[model samples]
Target: MNEVVHTSPTIGSNVEEIVFVIVVVDSTDRERISVTREELYKMLSHEDLKKAGLLVFANKQDVKECMSVAEISQYLKLTSLKDHQWHIQACCALTGEGLCQGLEWMMSRLKSR
Candidate 1:
């Protein structure tokens, strides 16, 4: 893959190539759902990350009040991201569940590229 360097004044002279982005959201935090969705939209819309794969971890799946992966995906407007490849995984950080599946999906995408 060709290097897609990113430059930021905050980290001056330290450029890194970005191939993909991972966003972890708290599924049990109902109040912050909108905020999380908005932030994700902003990131997906960024010009610098146009070609990057997006992996969203809908965490805290073990919580009874947590949102399901489908609900989170709908609220995040993931369908609008037609130009990029993305996936959302329901996970329980405490139990280490679904984490490997998420990473494996990411690796598959990278290998395909």
Candidate 2:
């Protein structure tokens, strides 16, 4: 399993080849989501990573006030990533809901590539 664990907003410029990038965000926090969008754009804009696949996981769906996938997508301005292949999935880590679906989606996209 190829994976890149990012612990900071400043992604390394040394990234060589990336198969897929999973961006996990808290659906209940609007401010964090916005920050995440900025970071995502910065990371994806790197010349070496432009073709990498992206999967945005809007987690914490179990929370009553959490944003839906559509809302998260809208706030993230995902449409701006028209040149990249991306998908947003609603998920709840507590119950493992939507986790497999998101992974499956990523796998399918990877296989197609």
Candidate 3:
């Protein structure tokens, strides 16, 4: 619903279930947004949500037009996430690279719980 690229309707029957929320961000204007890193942390740090957890797919990684992980992390101040299992991964959906790893990490996190 929120400018998402491909949204599969998962609100239904017998799916394995999604335990984590995957929050996407604009690799460019990280500063202009209010509901960015802070909101993500709020979601992840919610008392009830602590176990459910979450991940972030920093897509558009292959583009010369996109921000690097170091840059994005600096802007978001994600050093705290390193110790936590906040899976922030570099991905290029255009080339289908790193997509499986991102999804695999999500599945692993869910299964591990």
Candidate 4:
């Protein structure tokens, strides 16, 4: 029963039956991160998605000015998501770093549920 749902921040309200959500954000962009966080909050706040798993992929970790995972998590206030399961991962998609770990985490969480 592994199910994944991919959607843009704006259209999340249109989807249903979401077991996992992969939220990718640029580590250096505060504005984008803020918007993404709000969107994610709204989506997961819905009653239907209360148990959905969230994987916040902090992209562009290779960039020198990128923010740390702790900073991003604080900025996004991920701790406030008390009703959902979520994890943050620092990743560089171009070099394929940290992607597997995030996916594996999501898989393990889903399996546990």
Ranking by lDDT: 1, 4, 2, 3
- TM-score of every model? 0.81, 0.80, 0.62, 0.79
What is the C-alpha lDDT profile of model 2 across 26-71, one tens digit per residue? 9999868878888999999888678878899889999998888999
The stretch of ten residues in a row with the least summed lDDT in candidate 1 is: 9-18
Q: With candidate 1 superimposed using the best TM-score fit, by how many Å does residue 29's alpha carbon deviate from the native? A: 1.0
Output the better candidate (2/4) by TM-score. Answer: 2
- State the TM-score for model 4: 0.79
Tens digits of lDDT, candidate 3, 5-102: 96788676775644567766666555653558678778767765665645667777766777776776666666766435666778777797777888
lDDT of 4 by residue, 1-113 (tens): 59898876774465435487788989989767778778988888888787888899999999997999999999889898887789999999999899999999988886775
| Highest TM-score scorer | 1
Query: On TM-score, who's better, 1 or 3?
Result: 1
Whichever of 2 and 3 has more TM-score, that candidate is 2
Query: Cα deviation of 53 in candidate 3 (Å)?
Result: 2.5
**Clash count, predicted structure 1:** 0
Of candidates 4 and 1, the better by TM-score: 1
- Where's the lowest-lDDT run of ten residues in candidate 4? 9-18
Candidate 1's displacement at residue 61, Å, is 0.3
RMSD of each predicted structure? 10.0, 12.0, 12.4, 11.7
Tens digit per residue, CA lDDT, model 1, 41-80: 7887799888889999999999997899999998888888
Per-residue lDDT, model 2, residue 95, is 95
